[model samples]
Target: MFGRIGRTSVKHPWLTILAWVVAAFALVALAPALKSTTDQADFLPSHYESVQVGKVQERAFPEQDQPASIAVFWRDDNGPLTDGDKADVAKVTESLDKAGFNLVKKIETSPEAVSPNGKIALASVVASVKDPYDEKLLESVKELRKKAAPLLEGTSLKMGLTGSAADALDSQESSGDTDAMIMMATLVLIIVLLGVIFRSPLIALLPVLIIGVVFMVANGLIATAAEVFGLEADASVSAILIVVLFGVGTDYILFLLFRYREALREGQAPKQAMSDAVANVGETIASAAGAVIVAFLALLLSSLGMLRAMGPALAISVAVTLIAALTLVPAIFSLLGEKAFWPSKAWRKQPKHTLGKRIGDLTARRPGVVAGVSGGVLAVLAAGVLTFHPTFDAGSSLPDDLESVVAMEKLQSGFPAGQTDPTWVVLEKTSDGKLEQAEVEAFEKKLAASGFGEVSPGVIGAGGDVAQFAVLLKEKPSSDAAMELVSGKLRDAAHDAAPEGSRALVGGLTAVFADIQTAVNRDYSLVFPIAGLAIMVILGLLLRSVVAPWYLMLAVGLGFGAALGSTVWLFQGLQGKDGLLFTLPVIVYLFVVAIGTDYNILMVARLREEVRRGQNSADAVRHSITHSASTIGAAAIILAGTFGVLLLAKNSMLQQMGFAVAFGILLTAFVMALLLVPAVTKLIGPRAWWPGIKSDTARPAEPGPLLTEAPAGDRASV
Candidate 1:
């Protein structure tokens, strides 16, 4: 099947290239732009309490939809506000409301909102829209900020905005700016690294040029797929898509090019060598891509809608990359052949005692010791997973100097950290009719006395039967202490202290994060195992052996633990961070483990090929490592380098993700694939393919044919 694909692509290179170009342009021309949402409720199913609160708010108190944002006022002199300063707060609030801010209904300040110390006052700005995270509302907050600066010019109190709209505006700006940085860094890394590896400006630029087309096509397909399937994604997908497409695309191209160069060195005609390259490594690339696609598709089982959408979106990208790898890559390269590596005469002859050969010889000579040491190193690093702490504070992972974060910190100076974003408890009539003021006030007092903090009535709706109370916490909303307060005492008090005929529900950003924590924990138990099992199935099908897939997954599992553990050690232990991003484990498992499987598949497949071509187990290990090393090494370095570009971002999440992934790829390719997998397979002997006997007790190929080859005609194809 692979031979047929190679032959057809070789025979009709121009047509194949034209077909890809046409399809890419067609998709780009017709597909609508991809859309993403920032609404917290949108990320989870409707059943969660956080989501239910949003629905309840819309249905019950439509007027008190989320505050578009909050304006916090304090004396710029860092002292208590005089009565005149409070008057200025009211004056500025009224002026900002009248400033013609789009999407803002009206700004309101009250005596009750003033701190007891008289140093800080807050005015809640409500948006007219039900969805406060709407971009227009963020713009409204931006406009309101411009208006506030002028309004405060003669006042003693200074003002800053904090809350949903303000945070959204800041996040939009940060991510938007960082997107360009990440893309430029990625492209530069690919070009410079490829330039160094191939020593050809053309080859360095080729994958970038090709992947540019793949990016458009993949994005268009992903957008189309989302539209057709009703998949809702987050804004982060675009930047992520750029890295995945370029990184994976380059890896596939390098795999084929390395094989092509090998064929060229064996003296095959340019066109024939290209065909032979495709025929040999094509299945490996396909299987590698298949692993990634299926692993991503497994996110469909995720309870979170974000992953459900993201999983399929990324899966579509890898599928497109795979297609282009087998079809488009071969077609274009067939025409260039040896000229692809032009100006580098090294392609004409293989190098002697290459790093690959030395490593291969070491593993072949002492498989047991190599396996023991490599496996032991992975084991030692895996211990750090014991100290893993998951942080749901996505905002804290942002650059500290970002406006929203800075504003939030400034707001905290004169008020409770949670003042800008308070948790809400709602009491609703299980049936209908108005709630007695006595019962409502009684519930409020009960909540305050329970140490959940005092509550102020924010909205009374459903003819006074449904009521919402804003309860300010003492701690920052993103802190673990705050999560404990909300998920523990506040919720228990709310649920326990409801009026006779009413029920109470806690709702806020903190509650949302708490639920997200629960959702993530649930996903870890289900998603990781499911993705692992699915990948194992892919390996089993590709290798046609049950036993091999098990050990391969174990090696990849060890690699995953080591990757995550190292990140925890570096970021949490060494850097003294409170915790790493909660999503780190999931990200590491999917990209690192899944892609690691690709390297494992390539190496193991090569090992099997060497064994079948009449080499003993140890010699097959040597031969496989010697021949496939350059391909895996080049691909790993490029892929790892691409991810490393994320470190250029000031945001800690991207930095951590960059380091973990890049390190994991190198660990998988160099240590696990080269040392551990080969050593273990050599130790396992013929039974590694067992349940199915794929290798025979054939004579070993002369000690190092691949490392120090026989003549061109006599040597077998790599």
Candidate 2:
């Protein structure tokens, strides 16, 4: 099948190239803009308590105001706020009102809630608009910032905008930096590593150039698909897609190039070598990509809308990458011919027994010892799985230097921890009946008596049909305790305390994050099994052996467990954290299990190739490992290193994700690929390829197949 594909691509390289160009242009021109949402509530289903509460509030207290941003004010010298300072704050608010920002509702200032030290005061800016994340609101924030700057120029008071808007702006700026850093680092590392491996500038530049085209094409298509399907992607998805496309795209390119080099050394012309390279490595690349795509598509089962949206978007990206690997990469190479490796005569000679050969020999000599030792290391790390916990604190995901974080800390000292963002309860008449003032007062008294820390005076509806109360908790809103309290006792109290004709709703960050947790938990059960099953099917088809797929999947699963276990041990047991970020498990599972299969497929495919070439099972395992190890190891190291740079992000979620993925890739490459796979193949012997003639001793009628045409001396060198 792959051979036929190679022939068609090589036979009409120009046609293939032209098709890619047309597709790229059409997709880019037709694709709709990809949209992202930071609102946690946006990702949760309407059935969740938080969403339910939001619905209730929308219907009951439609006139309620939501603060779009907050302005935190303090004296520059850290002294008491004088009368002049209070007037200055008022003047700033007046100036913002005069500026006529379209989204600005009314700016409210309070001098009474100044800090005990008298160094700070607070002003809240509410938006008339419904969607706080709307770009217009961001524009309003920008205008407000500009207007407030000069209003305080001559005053001793210094003010900082510290709220959702500020946090959003900061997040956007930091994400831009992270994207630039990841791209630059990935490019430099890939070029340097590829240059070292191939020792040819053209060979090094080949992947960059080819994958660059693939990225543009893949992104354009992904955007089109996302738009057509109404998919929601995060800003981070673009950066991630770049890494995955280049990293995995480069891996497939290297796989083909390695074989192309081997074929060339066997005296095949550049054109025939290119065809043979694609034919030989094509199934492996396809299987690897199929696994990744299935895993990403599994995200559709996620209860969180964001994951569901992201799943198909990433799946589309990988699918395009796989197509390019099979088509675009080979076409470009076919055009470049022997000049692709120009300036490097090293391909004419083979290196001495490499590190991969030594490791393969070790595994072949004592499969039991290698398996036992490597498996034991992973098992020990897996012990940490018991300590793993999930954190709901979104604040922890943001940089501590953010003004919202700083002001939040300050607010906690003087006020209740949840004062800045309080949980709201709206009670409305359900039967088109008027809500009595006495009933509303009674409900507020019940809430205040429920030990909810503090309850603001109730604001009655203009028509006397509804009332809203702000409930402050003693704990930080995103804390586990807070979520638990809100999801449990507080919700129960609100329901039980409401009058017969009225309904009560609880809505806030804590409630929303708690609901998100439930959504993610549901996703785990739905996505994990489906993704695992889909990948197993791919493995089964690629290997043409049912039993092999089962064990191969088991190996990948163990790798996932071991990776999560190690993270749990480090973050929770050693560092004394309550839990990891809630989304870490899914991220780890998707990357580790999906990409782990790439290494497994490469090794298994090479093993089958060696076996087909008439080597016995044990010798085939050793030969395959020895031959494919360097390529797999180099690719894994580069991919893992690229993911490791995510730790450089200021966000904790990115930090944990970076460490988990990077470590998982290393574990997959070194422990599983290098050790477990070979040992198992040795133990299974020829039976590992049941239902296939991989174990049969049959030689081709011809002198040698194109893929195995490397000289005996060169084989020994590999």
TM-score of each model, in listed order: 0.92, 0.91
**What digit string (tens of lDDT, one per residue) describes model 2 on residues 276-355?**
87776777788888899999988887888888877887787788888888888778888888787788777778766577
lDDT of each: 0.80, 0.78
Query: Candidate 2, which segments miss by more than 4 Å at Cα?
Result: 61-63, 74-85, 96-103, 111-120, 128-158, 173-176, 397-399, 460-466, 573-578, 693-718
- Segments in model 1 whose C-alpha atoms lie over 4 Å from true places: 130-156, 171-176, 398-403, 432-438, 499-501, 694-696, 699-718
RMSD of each: 3.7, 3.3
In model 1, the clashing pairs are none
What is the TM-score of candidate 1?
0.92
lDDT tens string, model 1, 1-718? Answer: 7777888998999999999899889999999878898775689887777777777787887655457678888888879889899899998888887887778888998988877677778898888886778877888887787777877887787787877777777766765576687778778877887777678888889898899989989989999988988888787788778878877888788777777777877789988887777777777788888889888888888889888899999999999998888888888888987788889775565555366678889999999999999999888877789999888666787777765776677667666777867888888888666888788888888887887665775467767887788887888887888887898888988899997788899888888888888888898888888888988887777666888888998999899999999888899889888888888887787668877677888888777666656878888887778777766776677778777877776678778888999898888888899899999998898898776555658844434222111111112122
lDDT of 2: 0.78
